[model samples]
Target: MATDFWASTHYKRWIVDRATLRQARADDLLYIDDPEHLAFLAIYFAEVVGKLGKKLRLPQRAIATATVFFRRFYLKNSYCETDPFIVIAACCYVAAKAEECPAHIKNVVSDARQIFCHEPYNIKHFPSDNSKLAEMEFYLVDDLECDLTVFHPYRTLLALCKSGNGSEDASAQEEEAGEVGAGIPADDGPRYWGTGQGQLELPPNGLQTAWFIVNDTYRSELCLLYPPHLIAIAALYLTCVFHPATHETVSAVLAASSSAPASSSASTTPDPPPRRSSRQAAERKKPAQDPLEFLAELNVSLPLIATIAQEIISMYTLWDRYKEDSGSVATPDSSRNGEDDGPVVTPALLTVVLMKMREARLLEIAHPSSGRPVAVNKMLERTQAAG
Candidate 1:
């Protein structure tokens, strides 16, 4: 289950200093202030996640899952941790075997240098040294409290959107809308969000996750604080207003209504606010359920989740087309059903995998049919035939 960011090391040690957060305001990095950046990072690193998975030969789902974990962690905590660069790289390491995307520490470090390296910031400090990452790993584990599982809005949102024999109705739509980006309860006491909430605004994808965090909370079915749809809308509004998402993305959604359903509601709507990302960028946008929350089941299913964790391990290998030659499962899958078990591969999971890939620009969302069921490509070589 996805936990609060405040309780994370990100909240405690990593709040991005306000000065630093704004430092790029006057430079080329001004886009850092735009919300598109959040989408940008999630998309970008998702590629890294996939590449790492391939190099290590792990599953596509595991790679996508780890990327989401890294993105969510940064949303609440400022980027002021010992070395966020290190943490980002380390997260892939921690999420690897757990998510079943295994890689040698040496290889992980090597790839980190090759792909994610920024020109000025020496990549060496970013998880290359075993000693360094080991230290940060402990910090990450401590901050996250070994709570490494993350729930993604992709599948949750997709399920909510795709239910009912491939068509949706208003009531069903409302239910799907509630699946992601619910309202965030201010933490005055338990501070489940970690020590990072009161800190500066989150990182690029921080608010994106913020949108998810709030909504996932609502999906718990334990509260009436607000409807999940309301939370999704508001969170997207807030995220688009304040962070890397620009008015462009926000307005695009609004403008899109014209070509869409042409509901009476669309005609009465006001123009969205003027915000940042490239105007052309909005025109290129594709439809995604706002806040994209579809994994509401995690809120109340820890027992089932324990089993899913094991399944994640096998799937990671199945996708990578590389695994132990010995053919033993990295972690065993449930054998109780007298059924053939495979990685946790499903259409919903595939959507998240695809969303991450599209965001990373590795693949373009040209036509709806243009998209590939990449989840299968990476994992279908599930096993070799008997010798």
Candidate 2:
């Protein structure tokens, strides 16, 4: 019944140290082949959700939270363990629930199946007549160890922006009255430290503001350590910086948006891109030169497709750390963000997280063949229910 992130079952298991996960990622053979592949899958998945989130006009935070969920799950598990489409929908479903978006399972699944079936990653091998979702859900739980609490960076950004407005005015009065230090924590206080040596810049604005917000939140371990608000700012900021041209517009819009009280846009967003265009997801996005390329464009790091390939190898490293810390082996560290919360580790949660992950050395493989009757519909149901 308690929901503290640190006290949650997730905190006990899913989080990992970044440096440690990196070592495994570097040394492991599976991830060595294609780390980019995996990272991009996350980016691609986020893009799909982003479009839908935007269409529905949901708060950027909700969509960002969902994307973070997708990324964390994959970071902890693998693609084949359960269908990615299902995983993505699950993230949205969970995010919707967490954010109190009220998304139903049937709608999420039916919409996701329809979108994926028509667009990129045109997966035709899904099961057509099974509660494939239950199986996959079990797998997801297994891999993630049932840990589901997720934090993001967006909340920090809002707080910073809101507080900054007040602090800025206060500081303005300080300058007029006579420069004097207020009750601010010099180290983690409300000072706008900039790139220069000692000069304080104006309160962060435009794209840079987003970056600072993200960076600070990331450092807090929110993604794995703190909360999604931290990461949301990062993603939003990164999006702005990379696409400065568009970011300029985004900043202006967001600035105005920030002024309004927080509200969840309840209207259903546009559908995900059709599955027929799966292969073409790379080509369809029109991107900016360099920065924009990596920031917004899904294929910004296409060459890193191997990251996805490395899931198998890097995963072990996570499992090893988890096994050492928790004195167990079935579940692994969900991220290197290092907040300390591990996966749920309950049989039910573990069953959902680890559904598709299997080493080549392991026996009993389903092989994801065509006409598999995937449990996509049911997956949607559970996702909504769980959320």
Candidate with the greatest TM-score versus the true structure? 2
Q: How does candidate 2 score on lDDT?
A: 0.42
Candidate 1: which stretches are off by over 4 Å? 1-54, 80-82, 117-124, 154-387
Q: Write the per-residue lDDT of candidate 1 for residues 56-101, one digit (tens) a residue.
A: 6654444544554554444433322123345556677787756544
lDDT (C-alpha) at residue 172 in model 2: 48
lDDT (C-alpha) at residue 186 in model 2: 38
Per-residue C-alpha lDDT of model 2 across residues 1-387, encoded as one tens digit per residue: 323434555445655566644543342223223343333233345556765555445555566556666655655544543356666666666666556564666666566665655433344443442255444555555555655444433333333332223556545433322211111123532232112132111233433355444533321223453223223333443445444554565565566556555443443576576676774886787432222222233212322323321332343233333222222323333344354633322222232232323233122233434535433334433433332
Write down the lDDT of every candidate, Cα atoms only: 0.39, 0.42
Error of 1 at 97 (Å): 2.7
- Give per-residue lDDT, candidate 1, residue 330: 24
